[model samples]
Target: MTRHDPALSTPAQSALDALRANVAVPFERARAMPKAVYTSPEFAEAEARHIFAAEWLCAGRADALPNPGDYLTMQIAGEPVIILRDREGVLRGMSNVCRHRMSTLLEGRGNVRSIVCPYHAWTYNLDGSLRGAPAMARNEGFCKDDVTLPTVRVADWLGWIMVTLNPDAPNPADQLAGVERLVGHLPMRDYREVFREEFRWNTNWKVLAENFMESYHLPVCHAGTIGGASDLNQMECPEGEAAFNYHWIIKNDLVPLALAHPSNTVLQGDDRRITWLLAIYPALLVTLTPGYFWYLCLTPDGPGAVNVLFGGGMSADWCADPKADQHFAAVKALLDDVNVEDKGCVERVWKGLCAGMSGPGSLSHLERPNYDFARYIAGRMP
Candidate 1:
């Protein structure tokens, strides 16, 4: 006989473990994944494989690597990769690790006409081709071609740069081909990360993703900001399109397009009744409105620590204004409230489990949005 945990009941735990193997389903209509999925080290390792390794994850902006020789380096899904504008002005990527002695090639982002391994000084072109191997050649049959800084596959879509651990991985667009058509019409090229900051929050990255999937906290966490600026009572799930339970928060006069379902805050204003957020799989939250975007934390730096990255997606007016600073500050305050609400809940959950409080948590019958996220992750698992 098995001792059953309600939160980890056969049904809930089974479904959640399913997500550990696959993707999630919508909650309520589907089933919530188990708490262990969020807290387990094994689950994190699996995610690095099935999800991040296989999927097309966002690295940064194409504009960030504007000029030839300019490069940006980051670790994604545990791969130390570098993105660079080649000497030919082409965007490219290479393993940051040196092919020779395993020391990192580039220490940081800068304009380097060529990439060189700091160790033993093995050099490579901006294109990731080896240029020189200082002393290894005379020591052994060290051919540069076989030892070029192991380049990863790269593709630039719109203005975003994407890198894959797979050497011959299919294009990110192919994986997201469905997404492009679903929410493609919005002009995203003009928008930029106007505000950016990342901090370590002790919680699973999925908690950050889950927190952004619904507006349940608006009435409490951000009542002052969202309640006053937008309506919380009139929010509903958009009909027709199959939402994976992850979507963007739309605000008043602030929304620039016609959304399938209008959140109450926007219903009070004209031209602001609709905005759409494309919740790209594996934890990318983007709010696409005219001028700029409001965003949620990606939390991709391992599942334990969520790194908040968002800010202005300004339209022409916001970009050209002298008050851009004020606008950013306002966004920060508003986001701060939402973060406080979410962080409080997530931290409590983490602490509870640490204190052995793994009990079944309630899901609001009305919180369909949160359910969607639960389902999505559940489906992703096995």
Candidate 2:
């Protein structure tokens, strides 16, 4: 399918080309990252270099490392890595592969004083330093420093743990200025890590992102929840950075034609636009409704599997009354359906991308948000 994908949207050609026409952007960068970015081994490797290994990637929330020594194990750009809070209460990320023999050091998130690899009984401190060895001194000319886990770079922004697999990655604080300016005053950080699970997806990560860039698909795919409230006309992304912030606001349920303001004359069933779902480039999406929030982290496992992790957050006073409680429940249920629908669509797109029917494709006239995302992707490439 073309960039618009019937259910999706894209920006006008003139407007998009204008933003990208700057001589600073190489021709290859202006063009899409190419079909290989979504389907080929080479493109994926390049992304791993410029986007994952070299850039600060959001891994999870600070709460994952709440207490000292708590840690979360995840893969960044297909590299097995682990994030740990040392005894001093600082967060650090290191390659998860054991330094001695390449055994995985940890799996999932948990509390551990010292990570002792089950394979050879080698141990690493919370800060990723070599803490113990099965029989290191007995080996010929083996230096203890050489056996320490290779540390990756890490930075925490607004509670999200970011890992940079490339040792020479830039200062994350500087790299995130654009996003920081975009969300400066929003009450976004008041999130709690209440939920999470990983799903293996068979589609390109971008296809999944396109699914979320706008509410155009609400009226069709999510008619029961979001389609009931939001429509194509009211589904506008905010201006400038807000458009890329991946944030939205809604006051009603996801019912079709649901009214934004439910007065006495407004029917309860009218779906009228009361939700915001904003995504960061590569893959991270946040959904903000009247009283609830949902965050999705889409980490590409490989060309074949993408890890989609979901979590729920809410206001401090969500339990104020029965109505607030009810709204939260409804929001969670609606999002569940959203995930079900997205899974089917992306799986199909993955099939199409792998089929080689198309190489790299262009943007649709109405999908400006995606094109904007494309702009960010191009800027990020080395």
Candidate 3:
């Protein structure tokens, strides 16, 4: 008879055991993960500590902080962070907690000459050094120069800003090496930021990441917009690399914006006809088409919720066209409609997971990206 150990039987442990079982199955016969992995608070906490906190997470577009004093504040794995361009035009990341009372020093994005604590009015320079303390003069041996905001590692890759709370985490640029060779033909570096928006969804962060990584649902979920343009059978998910998972689908028809622009001779043959979607494990989801690219940076709010930062922009060549504005408006409308459809679908999936009426379901052959995603998560969990 097999013996069960009570020492390894917490809710998080059970969830991880189930997850390992699910991912252990062969790819051709794999089953979906247990709903507990998505609905258990204990499991979520484990992921927050083991995956999100230790991974290099996408924060936002570098263009958003174009000026030296520009800054954006966000929370990563429940830890508040500030990403900013300093006085010398260098980008930096640091804890947003005030050095004095530990209150949050920043709230949203804007240009700030200095970070001032709202609680007790402690001020910090753009580089995170203490500038002034309103009432610390009374304390003996107090050295303002010794105080500074805790610095977080930051990297700018392909126009996106990525931050890591783990000081020892590998730079995103290093992990994403050769990515430029894959999509370098697309004028990404020159693509200007159009707009950025955030959406709160009632679904696990993994669900959203998996949803974006595969093209299986495009024909049904995104039927009205990008669906008809893609051939579901033609979608191909190749073996994923250690850093990310990606798939490609040939478009039946060029998107309106792409059709309007002159062919980017740099992109040969099928490159002009294919769309690639990549998920940088744990959070960043990117979609690259012939004429433009967009991304979602997924962050878990808890076990059953996610906050997504959605943004995109036109290729520099396309943006140079005289009718670019009208074309972009059309693209934006289609994306908005698609997002609405996805929100409903994922939320319904979450509801189903919560109901507990279903067991692990078989995956479609096209869900290879998701299979890899499961393996990635399983490998990370304790």
Compared with the true structure, the alpha-carbon lDDT of candidate 2 equals 0.62
Best by lDDT: 3
Best by TM-score: 3
Model 2, backbone clash pairs (residues 3+ apart or across chains), number: 28
- State the lDDT of candidate 3 residue by residue for 1-382, as single tens digits: 2223353438878887888888877899987778888998988988888899999998878898999989998898899999999989899999999977799988888899999999999999999999999878889989999999999999988888988898888887788875676777765667777879998999999888888987888889987777888787777888787779888877755466643246466777787767778888789998877777788998898988999999988887788888888888888888899999999989988888889576668988888888899889988765
lDDT of each: 0.60, 0.62, 0.84
lDDT tens readout by residue for model 2, 1-382: 1122221112222222333453234333333334445665544555566676666667767776689978888887778988888898888878899888889979998899899998998888887778788777788888777667878788877677767776676565565566666544334455555566677777767677777775556677776555665446544554335225453535443342122323223313312344556675456676654344577777766556677777775543443434654665665677788888878866876787777565544433335566567667545554
lDDT comparing candidate 1 with the true structure: 0.60
TM-score computed on alpha carbons, candidate 1: 0.79
Residue 29 lDDT in model 3? 90
- Candidate 2 residue 241 Cα shift, in angstroms, is 5.0
Q: Show where candidate 1 strays beyond 4 Å.
A: 1-31, 167-170, 177-185, 239-250, 253-273, 296-303, 308-312, 321-326, 336-341, 353-355, 365-369
Worst 10 residues of 2 by lDDT: 1-10
TM-score of each: 0.79, 0.77, 0.95
